[model samples]
Target: MPRLLWPLLGLLLLAGCASNKERPELTEVDQYREASESLESRNYLTAIDQLKELEARFPYGDFAEQAALDLIYAQYRAVDYPATVVAAQRFMRNYPAHPRMDYALYMRGLANFNMEKGLFDNMVSSDKSSKDMGAAKDAFRDFERLVNRFPDSEYAPDARSRMVHIRNQLARQELHVARYYARRGAIIASINRAQYVVKHYQQTPAVPEALAIMAKGYQRLKQPELAEKSRDVLALNWPDSKFLDNDKQVDLAWWPDEDDGLLSLLTFDLL
Candidate 1:
C-alpha cells in the first residue's frame, strides 16, 4: 500500500504479462502436436486457430495435409457450417487424390445438409421441406458424388442414405408447392407441379399425394377424363394410399384449406 511499493507491484505485473505473451516460436511438428492435443480435448475453436496457423507456416510440411483435414473437422465440430464447407472444399481441391478424399466430400455434404438447421432444430420440427432447397440440393450432389466416386469408402453408406433422404425432401418440396397452388385456386399450376413430382420423383412417398392433387385439380377444371385417369392410376399403384378414400375418391383432408388470414398466420394453423 505504500506509494513506492505500488509502482514496483505494477512493474512486476507488466513483466508477468509480457512473459506470458512472449512464447517461444514453435517448430512445425510441435505446432501440429499442439493442434492435435487441442483436437483430442474437443477444444475445436482452439484447434482451428492452431491448425490454421500450422497450415500458414508450413503449407507443404509433413503435417500440412492432416492439418487441413483437421481444420475441416474442427470447423464442423464448432458448428461453423459455412467454414466447414469451405475448408472441406479447399482440402478436396488441394488434395484430389488423397486417401481421405471421401472424408472431405462427406464433410462438405454434411455441412451443407445441416446448414439450414435452426438453433432449436433438435427441439422443434421446423419442416425442412419448407426451407430453401439450395443447400439441400448442394448436399445431395455432394453425397451423390461421394457415392459414385468412392463406393468402397466407409462414408459412402451414410452418404447414400442421406442422398435418399434428400431425394424424398425434394419430392416433398414439389408436393408442398402443389398444395400451395391448390389452396390458392391455381388449378393448372397445382396440377403441373403435382405432375412434375409424379414424373420425376417416381417411387417417392409424395407420388400418391401428387396423383391425388392432380386428380382433384383436373376435376376442378371439368376435365373428368383426366381426373378419372389419375384416380385409376392411384388405385392401381397405391391401393392402400390414404389419398384414396376406400379406393374410390381422392381424400386430401390432410392438406390445409385456403389460407385462414391472420389467424392462420398467428397460429401457424396449429390451432
Candidate 2:
C-alpha cells in the first residue's frame, strides 16, 4: 500500500473504533439493567449516565419511566441533592400521576430538608449571623406540599416528621435572634423576634422561651402592662417557669437602669 494510503486507513480504523465506543447499540432493558447494576455497586455517576442514555434511546419504551425514576435516585445517592430535586420535579411534571409520584415529591422535600439542616449546626454555633433560614423555610413548604398532596403516601409520615423538626428549628432560630437583640439592649427588636416564634411556630417547643424573652424585653422597655400580660401568658402556659419564680416580688418586677450600678445590671436577667 502507498505510505499516504496506509496513514489514511489507520485514521479510518481509529474513527470506526471511536464511533463503536461512543454508541454501542444496547436494548432499553439491557441499558436499564446496566444502570441498575451501577447504582447497586455504588457507582452513582455511572448509573446516572446509563439511565440517561436509556431514557434518551427509549423515550416510549416500557423501561423509559423507570429509567427516569432511577436517575433521580441515582442523583440523590451521588450526594447531589440539588440535581436530585431538579430530576424529581421533572419526573413529576412529566408523570403527575405516576405510581411513584409520592416518592418524587418526598425526594424533593428531602433535598430542601438537607439544605435547611445545615442551619441547625450554624445556629448552635457562636456566630449567630452565620445562620441561614431560607433553606429551612423552603423545606417546610416542600414538606407541606407533599403532606397536602399525598396524605396517604408511604412517605407522608416521614415528611410530616421532617416538617415538625424544621418548625422547631425555626422557632429556636427566632429565639436565638431574640436573645442576640436582648443582649444588645435592642428591646423592641428582641420582642419582635420572640413574638414571631410565638405566632408562627406555636406548635414548636420554643414557645416558652419566646414568651420569657418577650416578658423580659417588655420589662426592660418599661412597659409594665405588656410585661405583666406576657408574664401572665407565660404563667398560664408554663406555670413552673423560673422567670416567674420572683413574679410575686413586686420589687423585682423590673430591673433598675444600668446606671444604677453593676449590682443592678448583674441581677437584671435573674429578676
Candidate 3:
C-alpha cells in the first residue's frame, strides 16, 4: 500500500522469478535418475522430457539405452501410440540383440494394438473389408513375430494371447464384409471373403459364421453342391448355429435392418 515499498516488492518478485527460471539443469546421471523416478511416480510427461534430455546429452551408454526404453514406455503410458511405436522400433533396430529386445517388440505390438478401433466399429462402418486394417494387421504380425522368435521370452505368452485376439478380430472383420456383400448381392466376393475366414481363421469364433455365410452365398450363386458342402461343415462344427436354423435368411438380426428397430437391434457381438 505504501508508494516507496512498491519498487522493492517488484524487484523481489522479479528476482524470485529469475531464480526459478535459472535453476540448474540436471547432470546426465541426475537426469536419468529423475526420469526413472518420474516413471515410477507415473509422471509420464516429466519422465518423457527427462528421458529425452538424458538421451540427447548422453547418447551411447547403458544409461542411454535404459532411457530409450523408458521413453518408449513413457510415451505409451501417455497414450502417444505412434511415438511409442517409433521409439520401440528404433530401440530394436539399434540394438538388435539387446537383452531387452523382447520388451521393445512387445511394446511395439501394444502400441499398434491400442491404436486399433474396436471390432464392431469396423463391422457397422461403411465396409469392413475396405477399412484400412493396417494397425490391426501390424499389431497381429508384431505379436506373431514376438511369439515365434522368442517363444520363451517373458512377454511371449501375453503376445500369444494378443495374437489370438487379433486373429478373431480379423476373422470377424472378414465375416462382416461377407455379410455386407451378401446383402448387396455380390455373391462371389461374399463367398470369397467367407471362405477366407473359414480357411485362414479356422480356430476363431467367427469360423462357423464364415461357413454359414459361404453356404448361403453359394446357394445364392446357384451352386447347390458347394452350398451343401459348406452347409455340412457349418452343421458339423456348429449344429446350433442361428444361421443354420434360419436357413438362407442370414439371421444376423444383431446388425441394423430397416425392417426392425435398427438402432435397438444393434448388439454388436463381433463374433
Candidate 4:
C-alpha cells in the first residue's frame, strides 16, 4: 500500500509540472492570435505593438516565432520598408531553419522591391540624369536571387514577372540617357548607350526605340551604311514601331547610287 501511494504521488507531481509549462504557452498563443486579428484588420501600428509584447513575454517559444513573422508583415503593410527589411533580416538570422524560411526571404526581397523608385521619378528634369539607380538595381538583384534560389516557391512566378518589368525600366532609363546625349550633340556617348540598350534589352519594349536611336546616331556620325543596316533590322523586327518614321528621314545617299532606290522603298514614311 505504501509503494502504491508513492507511485500516485509521483504522477501528481508530473501532472503539476505539465500544467505549469502549458498554461503560459497557451496564454501566449491566445495573445498572438489577438494580435494577428488586429493585423488582419489593417491596424498595423497596434498589431506591431502587440506582437512586440508577445515576443518579449515568450522569447524562444512557439508564439515568439509567429510574433516575429507578424511583426515583419505589419511593418511591410505599413510601408515602413526600412523597418521591414531589418525585421526580415533578423528573422532569417535567428530562424534559419524555420519552416517559413522561404517566406522570410521573400519578404526581405519584397521590402527592397517596394522601396525602389522608378527611373523617371529619380531623374533630374533639367538634365534627365538619375541621382541614383542603386536602390532599383539592388531591388532587382534581390528579387532575382529569390527566384533563382526558390524556383518552386509561391513567389517565384511573381518575382519572374516583376523582373521583366524591372529590366524594361532599367533599359528605358539607359535609353533616356542616350537621348539626352544625342540631343546635346554628343554622338559617341549616345551611340554607346543606345547600343548597350539594344544588346542587353533586345526583348524589352525599349529595344525598338533603342535601335532607332542607334540608327540615328550612326547617321549623325556619317556611318550611313551602319545606320541603314540598323533601320532594316528594326523594320523587320518592329515594323509598326514609331521610330520607323524617324529612321526613314535619315539620308542614306552614301550607299551605292543604284541602291538608293531600294533604300527609298524600305524607308517609305508609313506614319
User: Which candidate achieves the best lDDT against the true structure?
Assistant: 1
Query: Which candidate do you rate higher for TM-score, 2 or 3?
Result: 3
Q: What is the lDDT of residue 102 in candidate 3?
A: 85
Q: Compare candidates 3 and 4 on TM-score and give the better one.
A: 3
Model 3 ranges off by over 4 Å:
1-21, 117-131, 246-271
Pick by lDDT: 2 or 4, better one: 2
Q: What is the lDDT ranking, best to worst?
A: 1, 3, 2, 4
Each prediction's TM-score against the native?
A: 0.87, 0.79, 0.79, 0.71
**C-alpha positional error of residue 29 in candidate 1 after TM-score superposition, expressed in Å:** 0.6
Instruction: For model 1, state the Cα shift of residue 172 in Å.
Output: 1.3
Ranking by TM-score: 1, 3, 2, 4
Where does the lowest 10-residue lDDT sum fall in candidate 2? 248-257
Steric overlap count per candidate: 0, 0, 0, 0
| Tens digit per residue, CA lDDT, model 4, 141-239 | 777877777788898788788778778778888887776565555667878998998888879887877777778778767999998888888888877
Encode model 3's per-residue lDDT on 26-131: one tens digit a residue: 7787888888889999999999988887888889856988888899999999989999999999999888989989899999999998785564754575333446
lDDT of candidates 1 onward, in order: 0.89, 0.77, 0.80, 0.75
Q: Which stretches of candidate 1 lie over 4 Å from their true place?
A: 1-21, 254-271
